[model samples]
Target: MIWIFIFFMNIGIDIRTLMDARYSGVSLYTLELVQALCRYGSKNNYRLFCNAFRSRDGRPPRFDYPNVSVTDTKYPNKLLNYGYFKIGKRPKLDRLLKTDVFFMPHINFVAFSRGARYVVTVHDLSFLRYPYFFTLRQNLWHRALNVKKLLQHAAAVIAVSEHTKRDVIELCRIPEKKVHVIYSGINERYHPLSAESSEARRVRSAYALPERFMLYLGNIEPRKNIESIIEAYSLYRKKNPQSDVKLVIAGSSAWKHGVVHAVARASGFFADIHFLDYVAEADKTALYSLAELFVFPSFYEGFGFPPLEAAACGTPVITSNVAALPEIAGGFALLIDPHNVAGLSEAINEVLNDKNLQQNMRERGLNHEQKFSWEKCAREVVKVFENLNSIY
Candidate 1:
């Protein structure tokens, strides 16, 4: 039997990481990886190591399996502020040597851990390739440096998309064969809703969602290209004055509210735009189902999730053709360049005006959604754990 220990950036009672977790893809990836490991750990022994960022929050998230054991620094809140440097040495990897594999969901400190083999998931190289996307202060996290060093030593790496895999190979200089492209899976919570259910109506009442709305789901970061998206929406509304299509932006608002507000208020189409900052997870499905079309024209993504989730719910998608969007959306989406506001507006108009095209994309999207599965992702990851024996 093989033993594995999974390392996440942070986990535990406080949920501080959870607040900003959605903005970081690794947060969700870490959660899903643990769930996958828990499901398969019965056949292959496994345990988990997570940063208890807070000591007394609540029960740590788990999959009702006893094989997963969580270890914290015991004083995570203090360590969080000071980081590993001030917190003294981290939990010793040497103690985990009995385990055959050390799996890191995000790059972090590495302990050779006696004879344990290593595997890591590189969510993206955003920091290395595009540090300007983040604030100057954030671009210099000590842990970020540590994760990079750890990656160089890992036996293999898992990239959520080929785009990210390429980024890793080019930016980190990791070997191409060592990188596996395993996509993230959409939550079962996201799907087309039945008309009989009050799901859409319930969400509308809660979020004050207007009828016939265009949706943009994700953070309000500059990298998400919200300014460009709003510019395109403004143009779309100008050409079609009688259009009742409201442009709804949903998800966590980033550090710069002024920039986001400026983009929204400057819109001549303000009356037709809506922003629901930080929606509840439970309400996401209703929101996706109610949208007229889902537009995710992000500048870049490791593996764009909204378009895939929208396609899963049978919503027509208009997304950037760049990076992982094409790979993740497969052939189910209407692709447009993120920088091309006119192209985005045209794609939006075509989907809204042409019912036949929308229906075609809806069917293709449903088929595309079936191509990804968390179970398959779990099996593939387990293969990495099993292969650690060869490295040893």
Candidate 2:
């Protein structure tokens, strides 16, 4: 008779990032991954840890899974993080939570028992690769966390892409065997929506968006290279004066965002450019569907979501060739050099004038998007936990 061994363990998840009123890419990933984990890994017990020290009403979103429970505290984050950092694994997070494994969906200050193992998901190493892109305070915060040390000690590191896995191994010097590459899934909400739909019309009217505009949705920060999009759009307009296509720059502003606005105002096509500040999640699909094409000229990314999300919504995507952009959107979307303004302008013009190409991209994107799903990611993640638990 063949013998098979099966075991179950308690998994602790630090969910401090989810408290944001407006979730970032990482926050959304954590929320989706956690929900998927509960669904796919129902055999394992889950303990979600969140610290919201000052607000009595503060709580993470409620989950209806019997296998999932929460362990939260109202302790001030600054104090708790500092204590965790200084105390050097004194009060193990796993020990306190009474869990066998702990997982950080994103890198943050953490402590754990010496023998207890935990997994950490690394979405990107942008802060490390392009330190100047972040503020002094941000850099200080990263340094305070000693990110390299944290990764070194992690039982396993979950990289969002092969590019990110390579970065973890080379930059942080983590062993290749210690890192796992698991792609993030496209939310099911991002699919084709007709422009004539009531929701689409409402979003268009709400944002005062032009019908034939190309979109650039992401944090308006220098690292994202928003100016390149503006410059390229201006060039495209000047070259093709009869074209009535407009530019829509959405998403909330971040550090040094004033410069992006300044660039937009200085553009010759400034009148044609619209800044739809902080597009709501519910409106994103409409915004993508209304766009003629989605342009993301970011200089770097470990794994970009907007391009994939835009593509999944049946929108043609034109993203930079650098970083994980090509890795994720290569076969399905047009790629251009991030630093080449004229090239980017030409790319925009090429796509805008080619209806057949646009249709092809839309079809390909929908097909490519099918390859990634949260269920797959969660299953692989659970296997990581199982392997680590088995070793321990």
Candidate 3:
């Protein structure tokens, strides 16, 4: 039997569900991967670990599964940020559990107890690539030197996209052979909504959605290129005088500061735009289902999830040609230069005017959507675990 351990070092479900949704991607990915692997029926016993502050909320960090058991960095010794490292009065967890292999869903620098194999997943190098886009503290935390150490210590590295794998090799100077590219999988819940009458109305009415409005779903951050999307929408509105166009921006705010409020007041088209600070998983399907078209003009993404989610919901997508957007969109949606406001406006106009193009995009989205599945991702992960354990 293969014995394995997984560590959710930073965040957990409770935090993601309640605290913030921007960081939900990694937590959700870990849950889905674990679920899929459990269902795979491998002769593997899995142990999961995490860290939590204040045990008084009075819940165990452990999630029950048929073949999996979980634990947390015992209370009174939580991980606290110091000047440089997570300097605590006492060591936290310190990889106390014994397992054949250890899988870290995201980067964590904590030293293991002893003699445990390590696998680290690097979702994106945006922390390194777009250093200026982040705060002074985040940049210091995710420095290039820190990432290089993580890469060097890992037995295997998981990159969420090919673009990220390239970044790892170029930025961290890690060899190509050591990197493995694994695409993030969306839940089966994102599939095209069936012909249920209430499903359509509920989703539409909840958002007060326009009969013909475009969607841009993701956190409102600088790297997301929200300003450019708003500009293109404004330009499109100006050109199409009679067209009743609206842009919907959905997702929780990361910084939640003055930028968005400033954009809303300064952009003369405030009535034509909407920004929701939060959207639940169930509501997300409805949001995508009701969208006339979905657009993601992110300046950079390790692997863009909004486009993939929209495609799964049968909404026509228009994303930038940069990073892994093309790799995921794959001729299914209109590709535009993220920096070109006019190009974005034209692409949006073309998609709306051409019925044939819309129908074709819908069909291609269904096909492209098939290329990703949690089952496949889990199988690949299992293979990695098995391969590593076989050495013993």
Better of 1 and 2 by lDDT: 2
Model 1 has a clash total of 0
TM-score of model 1 (CA atoms): 0.89
- In terms of TM-score, which candidate is strongest? 2
Q: Which pairs clash in model 2? A: 52-74, 53-74, 53-75
Give the per-residue lDDT of model 1 (tens digit) for 1-392: 99997632111111223223343556666676668666754565555554554433333554466555555444443454455466545445536324556677776544454444567887777777777788876676633466556676777899998899999888878888888888777677778986346987888888998878999988888888888778888888888888889999987878575697798898877777888988766777888888889999888888887798888888999998888888888589999999999999888888898999989998999899888777788778877766655445
User: Which has the better TM-score: candidate 1, or candidate 2?
Assistant: 2
Residue range 272-291, candidate 2, lDDT tens digits: 99987787778898899889
Error of 2 at 38 (Å): 0.4
Candidate 1 collision pairs: none
RMSD of each: 4.5, 2.1, 4.6
- Candidate 1 least-lDDT 10 residues: 8-17
Candidate 3's displacement at residue 186, Å, is 1.6
- State the lDDT at 70 in candidate 3: 61
- Compared with the true structure, what per-residue lDDT tens digits does model 3 show for residues 160-197? 88988999999888888878888778888887775355
Q: Name model 1 segments beyond 4 Å from true.
A: 1-24, 53-59, 77-83, 86-88, 94-98, 109-116, 142-144
Candidate number with the higher TM-score (1 or 3): 1
